[model samples]
Target: MFRQLSERFGRPVAMAILTLLGMWLMVMVTLPQLQMIDYSFRPNLLPAQLGGPEDVWTLSNYVTLFNNEIHRAIFFKTLWSSVLVTLLTLVVSYPLAYYLAKVATPRQAALCILLLIIPFWINEILRTYSWFIILAFRGPLNEILLALGLIDRPIRFLSGDGGVMVGMVYAYILFMVFPLYNAIESLDDNQIRAARDLGAGNVRTHWRIVIPHAKPGIATGCIMTFMLAAGSYAVPALLGSPGSRWFTQIIYNWFFEGGNWNQGAAYAFLLLVLCIGFMSLVMKFFKVGLGDIAK
Candidate 1:
């Protein structure tokens, strides 16, 4: 009877079962995060005293968020840094993806793609630490520059915004590349040939034929890279100095070191909500849904 019902449902029953299972898994994993969310809304002061019950509910956490300019600045700074990193990734990955898709032979394309994957095989912390060595004051880059007479002293790259951006771009390039590659691979090469055959110039052919087709992947890559970059705590904390700290670093500090989970949760939820809003805005502007990109 179950088999017959599943067959009659035409895969939907299977999907529904899987969906429910997935939701259950997600809820289980997220229970602690949900507790944190609940914790964020509680009033920290004037609670558990003066006959107040534990977990006193209040909106002051969020209200304090709105009232605090420093927190707002951190949020916007993180947003901007993520945006910049995503844009840089897209710019760097696009031509590489285009070449791999349109020009490179199968063997060569496979090799290039392999190079991108090679970095991930190493521990991510190892990769970030490797950059620290390269970018540090007494590192090889500085030595070489000194040899070349570029400067009298070592340059400061490991503890600045420049180092943070570099680390972010390196870490997130694969996210940008694979999506663009997929989009470009799915494009009908015949249409491009047709455009060329009709005397359409390269610029015209690309703008009229390729750009619209690849829009979904562009959107996907940007959204993915931006979200990951913005939420990353390790890269920023490792590479950046106090003045250049990313907002995730701030949230992590508040949560772990400061022992103020309420503020931390507030910060985290704001970041989450902002990311959702960014993706929604992108989808609306591009007229493409996440499902469209999945194909």
Candidate 2:
């Protein structure tokens, strides 16, 4: 890889780039992760207990997570819900990506891309709060439904998992779309034409030709969407009711509300592990390597 980079960009440039990347990984990623791992292995101590005999290293934080049934359930629930959100985003974005990549004219595609990006110009917190307002009991949706006589009363949309899922899908849909678009745009039009000429239907052409080409992008999109959804704290906190507990919320409580940084670090480390495992599984399933995604 380094040889290829050097040949492409010259040896000095490649060395400089590699040095910066190495520094970034060491300072920004590795050091923090190591610190978190250290924190996770130690017991929580009060300010007065600092440097005392009680401030000993232990695995009690991880043990607490395993022993607590509620935490275990919430952790798994967060993992699966994030997966569902990633799938939902892919389903909803693929057609739009196809349209942008293969169907729409250049001008129309540019317009559509702008429209998609406009929403992100706003603050994410504001966007999530907008969903909260839209899903509230007396919000615009309920008002319209009541006027249309679809229902006699307002539906409580914000008090369940449905609202969180909706917000998640909407928020991360762009991540899925852009990757798929990049992948699909690189496909040769002639291949598609040939497939159609050979009496292949739309479904078969896409399944046999287009989808195989888009696997790397799909994997990339899924990884990004799943990681964002799983680690997200704001959307779930704002949209989810108390009954719908997200794992990040649990981590937040452990760190801030419960004043237990050790437990929080343990939860954070576990989440990191789960995300790595998920990404590995996705790469294996799609038969795509990291090099393919980098392309």
lDDT of 1: 0.85
TM-score of each: 0.87, 0.91
Alpha-carbon lDDT, every model: 0.85, 0.94
- Judged by TM-score, which candidate is best? 2
Please tell me which predicted candidate would have the highest lDDT against the true structure. 2
lDDT string for model 1 (1-295, tens) is 4467578786788678777877887788678778888878875544436346655677777887688888778789889889999999999998899889998999999999998899899988889988888888899989999999999999888755888899999999999998899998888899899999999998898788887888898899989999999999788878887778788887888878988788888888889999999899878887998798677
What local lDDT score does residue 295 receive in model 2, on the 0 to 100 scale?
77
**Candidate 2, residues 1-295: lDDT per residue as tens digits?**
7899999999999999999999999999999999989999988888898789987889899999899999999999999999999999999999999999999999999999999999999998899999999999999999999999999999999887889999999889899999999999999999899999999999999999999999999999999999999999999999998877899999999999999888999999999999999999999999999998787
Question: What is candidate 2's CA lDDT for residue 216?
Answer: 98
Q: What are the RMSDs of all candidates, in order?
A: 3.4, 2.5
